[model samples]
Target: MVMDEKGMVMNANSDNLPKDCPQISETVNLIVHAGQKYATKFNGKMFAFDQQQWNVKPCAKINITFINDDQIRHQFMIHGLPGYLYPDGMVHLELYGEGELKASLIVPSQKKTYLVHCELAQHAEKGMKAQLKVGGGDGDLPNISAISSPIKMDAYSIDWTMLKWGGMVILVVVTLIFVSGRWLLFRHFSRRK
Candidate 1:
């Protein structure tokens, strides 16, 4: 783990190989930007990474540059890796605010899906979520922004009862004001004539 004023990096491996991987297959240079602007495409989301999915060959070494554009803390963490090479099977890169950090990790030779997200409270839930697929991956994770659907989706139900009555009330008030204004103008013009 390496931490400084700019950011923190945990369990980054450049040369080390997982037991299942005899050698690295490929190297991916991934530059990810995290901010509220990225979440504009996802409905009801407040934060997101520029991309929601990444695919790589098994045993691929990913060189990641994580950039946080927001003024708040954000983390880029990948979970469900081989525990031997990565402590608790995770690679974490975090920035306190509006900065960038570079890190690397080698995935094992397994066709599996790994969760990549921000660990800050409600950050992932708010849209800072993504997926890394090794050899096409086992399957997509739930609620990955535009990638997949959520387990239990958020309900945005409208109060039909309020809208119904409120709409009628507004319409009636507007009509009354228009009629009264016309009547006053008619009376004033008659008096002038």
Candidate 2:
């Protein structure tokens, strides 16, 4: 038996824990390294190098350390959780620049799967997405390579170019109609005079 910081007796005896429960030795340390690139692309789509996956156990006190290698900014965010587990119903860690960030979160003793990803636009859909499982609930998260991700085309891509062309065509047609209507109105007035 050992006394915790709160002066509570913590018995390490096997009988005190569930039969299949793994021994809770200490707080678990989960390290995540962030950079500006990914290993490979998916289906010719560029993968965003913002988010990554991590596997953890339920009821475990997790200490997450984020190491940013990029020159810009990045974030590590986990979503889809009960409000009681977190102050704002999310686990958010932001790395403003190239440095390290540390945060802790307690996983509830429940069996569930959650989404871990970056909140940047199209980042999650590109490749900045991951999954977290607690209590071994699901079989496993799909392998990063096996997961099919949507392509994140830039705003000036072929699709947007077509859209812009369509808008230009509509604008020209509307302008022509307005100009023809004004000319017809002027002709009618002059004929009346």
Measured by lDDT, the strongest candidate is 1
Best by TM-score: 1
Ten-residue segment with the worst summed lDDT in candidate 1? 150-159
Report the lDDT tens digits of candidate 2 across residue range 51-159. Answer: 4445567666667776767665566676655564454557776665677766666666667677776576765555656676777556444434344333454555578
Q: Which 10 consecutive residues of model 2 have the lowest summed lDDT?
A: 6-15
Task: In angstroms, give how far residue 70 of model 1 lies from its true place.
Answer: 1.0
Cα misplacement distance, residue 38 of candidate 2 (Å): 2.8
Candidate 1's residue-wise lDDT over 47-152, tens digit each? 9999999999999999999999999999999999878889998999999999999999988999999999998999999999999999999998999877788887
Measured against the true structure, the TM-scores of the candidates, in listed sequence, are 0.79, 0.55
Estimate the lDDT of model 1.
0.93
